[model samples]
Target: MQAQSLSYYEILHLPPPPHTTPTISEIRKAYHSALLEHHPDKSILTANDSSTPTVDEIVEAYNILSTSSLKVLYDQQLESVQQSKKIEEARFKRLIAQADSIDLDDFQTATSCVQHSKDIFAESSSITLSTGYARESCHGYPEDTCNLQQIWFRNCRCGKDDAYLVTESMLEHAFLESDNAQSDDRQILVQCSRCSTWIRVLFSLAE
Candidate 1:
């Protein structure tokens, strides 16, 4: 299905405001205005059309955009859309790994390969690698259970097996690494001194 096209600010018809935040009163006012304009009952009566969206739509939109937790979810949805094009392009490039048609077993293997590549490249000063994977598990028992995984990597060593998991913190670290490695041949391997599950880094020299 095509995703919804409403952002928090757009839902409330407000300008793209700063993260400094708005007060509850301001939120409520914006919500009420949106409700008045879009409530299906009013629209149907005035426009004599059954295709108008219902009051529930307005309520749901307001609930999502006005509350802190819901607002965060809405913001994430927006971000997902904004990043979707880049994600699709990356996925297309990895078509051979059938990275687009990966299974659970392949996913785990791909993740390990990608992580390994990132670790190796992260030791250099001129290049860097970042990897990420995301997967969702099925809801059934042992036999029926399964997971769908999506992997992504960037600026790291590109190899047949190098596909990694994606995470919010990883993205932030990658950005920081990119910034720090701009002028130096310095390599930084940001790995867990313990489990070593999460790794992000920049490098200047060969692995």
Candidate 2:
């Protein structure tokens, strides 16, 4: 994923806003852990796992997050991006509804007009679980027997209850890349069915 598209908190594996800001100690711990896990040598050892983030990217994320002044600026930008997304989502839905009666050419034109808005929010926006961070077990089955996989719900800012549905496989995918389950928690992005807003589910995998 592009570094600009993700928050510094995510790069460091710490919870982002709408949740408590991590302490310096927590940030330091996460930075060291990320360095160990996503090290260039580690990537080489793993046969050049293309999915691994570059060391420079990790260091950049650390630099911004570790500095209080930069962190504030970063947080403001995140908020601005989120606000723009919500506005775009609302506008797009209205346009879609209105476009139903328009000709195909007109519909295409209308959509293209909002391309900039779409680009701004194209990446999955991250957020914590409404139920708070909870421990989950995998039940020895790859993804099938994770009993707690029952659809978890989160309310959306759109005033819809249970609009964000957390599914079984979503949990599995987050931890799939990990060589160690107990090392740290992982995040999976989900969207609000009603608002089309993306959410990052931060969760832990318990053996």
> Best candidate per lDDT, number?
2
The estimated TM-scores of all candidates read: 0.33, 0.45
Residue 84 displacement in candidate 2 (angstroms): 0.8
Clashes of each: 15, 1
Tens-digit per-residue lDDT, 97-128, candidate 1: 33222222222222323323333345443332
Q: State the lDDT at 82 in candidate 1.
A: 66
What is the alpha-carbon lDDT for the whole of candidate 1? 0.46
TM-score of model number 2 = 0.45
